[model samples]
Target: MTQVPFGDMKAHYQQFKSDIDTAVSRVLASGHYILGPELDKFEKDFAKFVGVNYAVGCSCGTEAIYLALAAMGVGPGDEVITVAHTAVPTINAISMTGATPVFADIDPVTYVMDVNSAESKITEKTKAFVPVHLYGQMVNMEPLMKLSLKHRIPVMEDIAQATGSLFKGAMAGTIGEYGAFSFYPSKNLGAFGDGGMVVTNSKENYELLLKLRNMGQSQRYHHDIVGINSRLDEIQAAILGAQLPYVNQWNTRRREIAKRYNEGLKGLVTTPQEASYGAHVYHLYVIQTENRDEMQKYLSDKGIQCLIHYPIPGHLQKAYTFLGYKKGDLPVTEHAANHILSLPMYPELTNEQVDHVIAAIRDYCKEKNTASVATPMSAQVAGR
Candidate 1:
């Protein structure tokens, strides 16, 4: 049996071994690890790449979102609206700001935040809208932005799974007031370890972010305001900078692989839907099936590793019980959590491996004697 891992970070490292080694060596040789020249250059380059005027390096993705919200004055007595279908980190970031996280349902087809659901969740206390770009696809931002302007609420994009995605020709993170990105080892533009960035066009927010991420210091030994320590380390900065130039190439390959998967898995399961508003970067190639658990177990037995992007919606989780959300509060989000399964996805996966995985999935459907039924939305997206 051919083993297909969910993501191959070792293979990724091998592909860029020399460049990564050089970056690590350079950082170590400098002995300036925190808030140094390497971080400075990476921040500038990342901002340029995202078409933003300023970028601030942070300790991790959750902190990136927290810093952006903190800059926007989101705190206790405020409400931040986002989807419950995403990784807990998205909600965790909102919770870290001492604000209440309001839940919204997701689109049945695209599996991202449903704009209508988001708008309905807003109240006088709503201070910000965080449209998480889940599974590498950008949320439909135009209507969301309109709502933001109407309500005087800020928009912060959680681009943790969508570093290079686009929406209507605009970069994912550039459309909102602030964009938060993660460089976890498996992202589209990953680093060797934990890393993150926050991008924005507002100079006021940018300057505040700088101080906030650095313990609210106006100068050495001068504490300007209350802040937390969340600086992006120099070594991770160097690693991310070294890999920055290859993001487009990697994203293109991810799209190609997605196309192959779509063609191969068409009627056997409901594949990811690429919305007309944006290009999906395929950070994780997810599919929906009725018997998701059984399929996952079968795939594992076949040496094809599979996992769930999320099996429990945030609003229904034990930690969030205090928020008073029930199981059916977010119907679409809860449905997706039970049905979605993530396949092996990465730029380095070979054609043979992809085909083997596809073949295994097809075999599962055949053995079960039932093809997964595509929902009305899925059928429309698939043009069936």
Candidate 2:
């Protein structure tokens, strides 16, 4: 049996080789590699895809979040609440804005930010609610919206992980004040290198973000306000545009894989659960299991790759010790940090590979059970 790789960017690239080559050729022929016609078209098309009025591409997903927050005037003396269970980039974005990232716990099931924890973290200085649509599942945004409205704070979505995902009938990015997305090569619709975008309904905020991405300048050599040079490259824009059409198709396959795992590992594994309003893109088919390490090693031995979405909770990271969070601060987030495992999930993953992963997990659990049985005899002998 051929080894199943963790992420196969090479396969997707080969599949779209002609399109990618053409995209690159067009950019090279145009002689305009920065923000140009192709970038504009991609931004507009992506905005339409997300049911938003505008989408501004940037250097990467991390920059996308920081630019959106900065455009919203989130800075020192302000607080942005988000999940502690996400990638470090989300927390880093908040810190970049000079704002304190007030963390919230996760819903034990969805593994996204808990809205109740967000509510409790709100303070007078809270300026925005940045909910992470972690692992392509939307945070229960209805209650999050209510909390935002009550506190009069904006919700900037860190949709870095969810590309084709939907929150309710509306698309993921459109539900919040600003939705930030990533186009890293591994994402559903990724770019050659790092790239990102911000989507929104408000033309005013959209304009601000555009200016911020380009050194706060509306036009070349005409600087209006303080900004950063974080524009998306024209070449990446062309590449992403070609892949956009296939995003939904890939997401569907991911969902099918998720369903297969849910049924196949019903008794042994705890698979992801979808909220009624959520249309999951399944960016990472993460499972909650107590034997995460053992399962990981078991799968590794079978030549199946597995990874942890996050091994360390954000609060425990040395960078944020000053936040005054201890090991047990947020029980749910901390506990989950130890148990989460990301199985190989992608559109191209085959049925045989999926079965191999499942079989390895079941076999590992059975062996452990048998081991504990033998341990009792050793214990009794020691006592005598």
Candidate 3:
């Protein structure tokens, strides 16, 4: 039996073979691959798409986060608030900047940083906050923005999962002081390889971020400040530029697939929520379920590919346990780690594949229930 894939990058690449090949060959022929015209054009075009004044292209999403923080002047003795349920990269980016990452629990329903919790966790050392647009759903930026306004703290948005999402007519990346986007191959607006960019409305900050990504060189080998090397490659920029025009269209297809999944799995699992003010881009189509492990195994046995977005929350990881988070400290974040199962999702996934995955899940649930019923009722109750 052939197995399906969670992310079908080859299928997506096949759709733009000619343009991608041409873009790469052009860069190879130019012999000027690093930070060339391709990158400049991509930055400008992406900034316009996000409704921002400036964009600074960087090497990767993690690098982009660090650069954005540096540009905003966050460093040692500073603290930035973020959710612990997300990827470790978000928190590590802050730690790598010589700043402490103060984490709050996510909202169980929305899987986004709970603004109320975030506020309660702020302290004197708090210099900035990152409200991640987790799993393609925009965080409630209005409240966070209001909080930032009240406290005069800067906000850098982690919009890696929400490339084209919006909250109340404002784009996801445009609401904060700086918005960092990832073009990892699995993202909705993915590049061929690793890439990320930071967008900002502040001209000075944008210039600084640009400089920070290129070893602080205001000019050739002219070191302005201590900075790290992180530049987006030219070939990736060209590929991303070619695909930029069609990002919205692909996201629309993803939305349609999300709708089908919602309808198909209504009673079987807890589907992702769409807040009244925000649009969801369906990055992974993550479904919450109590039987995630068993479901994952069943899907594998059926040759259906599934994945867990994160089996371990960032705060509980061995790398971050030194931050003083003990088990059972964050109930919501822990619950999320046990339940999130990412279904097969991509813009190019066929309708038949979607239906097959849905049916497999339904059948698996039925079989599990039947097996449990076959056991003694008293034993089953005791097990529960």
Candidate 1, which ten residues in sequence have the lowest lDDT sum? 375-384
Top lDDT model: 1
TM-score of each: 0.97, 0.95, 0.95
lDDT (Cα, tens digit) per residue for candidate 3, span 231-252: 8899999999989999899889
Taking the tens digit of each residue's C-alpha lDDT, what string does model 1 give over 237-355? 99999999999999999999999999999899989989999999999999988989999999999999999989988998899999999977877777788888999989999988999
lDDT of 2 by residue, 1-384 (tens): 557778998888888999999999999999999989999999999999998999999999999999999989999989899878999999999999999999988777777888888888988999999999999999888999999888799999999899888876778898888999989899888899999999989989988998999998988889998999998999999999998999999999999999888877876767787888889889999887766787788788888888998999888899999999988787777767888889999898988888888777778878876321111111222211
- C-alpha positional error of residue 223 in candidate 1 after TM-score superposition, expressed in Å: 0.6
By lDDT rank, best first, the candidates go 1, 2, 3
Give the distance in Å from residue 290's predicted Cα in candidate 2 to where it truly belongs: 2.0
Question: What does each candidate score in C-alpha RMSD?
Answer: 2.1, 6.0, 4.8
lDDT, residue 74, model 1: 97
